[model samples]
Target: MVRNRELLSSGNAAFAGLASSFSELSETLDRLASVADDRTAARAAGLKARLEEFSAKITFVGQVKAGKSALTNILAATPGLLPSDVNPWTSVVTTVAINTKAPADVEGPTNTKARFTFFSRDEWDNLVVGGGRLGELAERSGAQEELADIQRQVQAMRDATKARLGRHFELLLGQNHSYGYVDPELVERYVCLGDDVTPGEGNPQTGRFADITKSAELFLDIPEYDVSLTLCDTPGVNDTFMMREQITLRSLRGSELCVVVLSAHQALSTVDMALMRIISNLENRQIILFVNRVDELQDPAGQIDEIRSGILATLKKFNIASDVGIVFGSAKWGEAALMGSYDGLSADSRKALEQFGAMHPELAGRDEWETAWNLSGLPGLLNAVAERVSEGAGKRLLERVRRNARNLTNEARATLMARRSGGAAVTVDFAGHSASSVMQQLAAKYESDVAEVCQQLRDDLMQRMQSAESGFVKRATDSLLEHLERHGESGTWQYDPTGLRVLQRAAYLSFARAMSAKLSKLYEDAARHVEAIYSAVLSEAEGEFRIEAPHAPRVPAPVGLGKTIALDLQSTWWRRWWQKRRGYEAFAKDYAHLIRAEANSITRDLEENQVASVLENARAILREFLKEHQETIRRITQPDADTAEDARKALGVLQAGTDTGAAFGEILRGLDDMAA
Candidate 1:
């Protein structure tokens, strides 16, 4: 505020300059998209990259009273996320992301649990008393004390949820994390709690009648698309007092797609109007206008045309398109469960069929359902979101991206006035010994080995050098663990490093990072060496006739042949979550038993050290691969530096010291000194 005021009092140069630059940049972006200046060009490039990155984030939004949640469920072809008890359950604005992979792992701020962390119908009976842990423990144990014996109650509940917790879902553990929501930073912090948490009753403050804690977030790993989709199911808008302001309004800013759900009974309201205002800014975004709870207005025979016209007019006034995008659907995700259609509906089916269609015609039209029994009415909504997301966001990426980059030469004109207006200013002079010679020597050494390593890896690995997920998981976990130790109850607002445990004990995550970094480096070394060797060797063979370059005999074969890393060691969901359940348990038990039974098995096979044996096997594999592809080998040990530079330019390769992970880079810099 002070800065804003000062700028306001002075010539409106600061803000005005920004605004003017913004206008120019916007126009420049419309015409010329790239500039020569590093910072400006980088910002534009970065924004364009992000624009293409989140192209699949489809959001369902609306007012508190609007049936956004219901419509989201309807679009998803499910019973829906929150209860449809005419309440405000979307308090927190949950975002459900779904990927192509099987839905098994669920992450939260506090824990990373798998599918078992979720609950089954029968299992829920024993776990919950009141909605919250603080309340449930107090009510179930018959305690009326100032502070509920939280630890004891938590322990008991933990026992009840033992089989399910680590089995079903994974808990991420923290205040900022939510279930079903996975950020790259949070993946390492991901504590795999199972999915079997059995949901009983959650808070009924809002119209929330049911709890789908297990289904809180949906993460689908669609390998076919090489993409993951997360669908956030927001808490009811009516429940928490903190919700009245609206977070969807804030979060929907960069959304590529959104669904505004309105109830047929209440076509539009003040709350709905406020929501539209937020969405109005996103002209580039696509929204699915879903009218939910058509049951109340089932007699479309009487009000169908009127309701349609009302909706159409409202959309027109708001400049929203009117088409099949506006559909009447049910907010109920599991109507079959509520309607009792599971027992092969006969009598009830006959009586409620019309109401079912009237209430959820959207489901009836879906390919997943239309079985007359609504056993899978939910599939329609889920598929619709995916379909619409793909279709709606199908615009040309290069064209839609419009952040223009101005010519770097314009800097001269823009800043020319700075000298004339200011005339003279305070100046400082520094005289320090230059370390050019030392820098030259250091640069030479780095350019010799590290540079070679980087070039070799770049030619071979491209973007595969770092696993984005694994990298992010480690960083995010470390960050959150630091946050926890700094603020968690056990630490009691004090982050201490009094003894050996200080830095080492920041969070278990620190140790995890240490391990992860070590593994990454090891794997990186192997992959880089192997790839560099292969590419370098192969390229040497390809350019055998070129007399300009020549070096030592470099084997073109795969680095380590039969000697391969353990297949299970790769970053995988099975290793992360599945193994924890049936696979992990079986492997652990069987391995333990075998280790006990066959004392000589280790000596014979593993030496019998399993880990070491796996590495040896990997090496063998690489060796054999090289022997087979011997023609592809390059005999050159190290290519000439000058020629390598020229080749890099020809191949569009350049050493880009790009560090967008600002925080990560800072940590790396700090660690570099420690490493040295």
Candidate 2:
């Protein structure tokens, strides 16, 4: 394991290297983007966007009510930084990182603040329209008498959505909705609670849209923690809609460490297990299962043991070889203990602790309480995180810097060689083929490859669709029908008409979400395929032309509405609402077919259109790359002194590993002098 201090040193070195490398690369890319044609400039812009700082992204994710917010608060050393409560409150991704305040003297007092991004009107509309599972709601609702209440809730949701959405209620809204930052004191206004917390404040009738905020980035200056650390407080994986899950997954992408906060009382919930499988099974990520709220358990040790055993069994069942580290802790108690003084503790928390101490006489002393707090498992988890981060972060940073530096150097060399040759020099050929022919072949190959890849993606989508239809869809369908069959009451049929419509809408929306999620997965897989193909094409193109260029990372497609397919179910069940449970069953059966068809249509369009577009765009990028600097390459017969000097400096930096930054000479001299 990397020691904390050493890790910090290496991490700093790596960061400095990246900062220097990016400074140069971004400058070059900016110039290229500025001069290039519209298409080329756009592509270059995408590549430039990828040149971000290599911060160790630590993501906290889990099922709803897993104490993640509380844990984030404790880690940030700001109790109210995130609103942690028993209620399932937060619905947006909140990222916390060190804020190096610019022009330090311009600031009054240094304090943490958050910048929030609200959802576009369209995004809010989607969530409001996409209702949840009818079977789940029915199971929870219980008793035929609750049907009236359920309808009322549905009507309330509709009313609230209209009232909050205002102008957007009648039409699909765009992303032009405004967003702003909150003052340090009002951070909670944006992050904590829902839109109901502050009604008529910013976006009127924002209750239905409370879950629509895009993200919140909290910037803080904490002394104990390294400034390089970035903690991502992701939304619950099981938040109301599939889009929310997409947001969470996107945040987790390229994260260095993923901490899944599990509730001790709840343990590995169904959604928690699903989330676990996603991060552990699919991604190459270091994971920590933080079993939170352990204080709620009577036998925390025994409970933790049981939880670990279950987790291990699940991991084995899933064929995951990684041994996930488990940490049991209570964020509430740990935060209090870390604060040292109880003055910051809430009255309820203090009373609860006092009652617990009174109940357990042996643990009455203050030291013992502190010990118990320590035993909450935060200290060990913190140490483990620090060590793991120290071990991995430096290497990650260095690799990024090295890659950028190498790319920049190669590009410079190519430019210099071409410039000296005077647009006539041809050092090499592309695999025995001319550059023009090779470029043409590449375009054709990409087209063919996209078609073939899309076919494979379609097949995969169909297979997954079959599995989901059999698994989640069938289970949800059968369970609801069985419940309805068991509770056959014709007198309650009067209450059924409106209630059944509400339920049918909910059921259709649920099915649509399921299909949408599957489609999202397919899109992601297809994106990966396109990325791989693009990389392979770049390699081939470069090898053929005998030209070296900086290997810019594959630019990802931006998150947009294209990933989702809007569904408006036909009015087959609207007239049959009086038929009660049988009507709901029929509606669901018809709706499933519609959903399956929609899924297929969406996937086909993605396969034919989106996937092809990505490949074509990638091919265009290669073409642009060649066309952009070919003249420079051709013009170089012999290197000028200045050109040679610049190339030499770039090559020297590359040769020296580019990880030493500006202090490399000083360090090297010290080493040499010590040796002498």
Q: Best candidate, lDDT-wise? A: 2
Measured by TM-score, how close is model 2 to the native structure?
0.55
Residues 523-576, model 2: lDDT tens digits:
344334333323333322333122222222222222121222223212223233
**TM-scores for candidates 1 onward, in order:** 0.35, 0.55
- Candidate 1 per-residue lDDT, tens place, 459-488, comes to 332222123223333443454356545654
**Superposed model 1: Cα runs more than 4 Å off:** 1-55, 63-67, 70-90, 100-218, 221-228, 235-244, 269-271, 319-324, 333-352, 355-368, 371-392, 396-676
What clash count does candidate 2 reach?
A: 16
Global Cα lDDT for candidate 2: 0.49
- Give lDDT per model, in order: 0.35, 0.49
Candidate 1: worst 10 consecutive residues by lDDT? 544-553
- Number of the predicted model whose TM-score against the real structure is largest: 2
RMSD of 2: 11.7
Model 2 ranges off by over 4 Å: 1-52, 86-90, 99-113, 129-185, 194-212, 223-229, 235-257, 269-281, 284-286, 298-303, 314-322, 343-376, 379-401, 411-676
Cα-based lDDT at residue 213, candidate 2: 52
Error of 1 at 425 (Å): 44
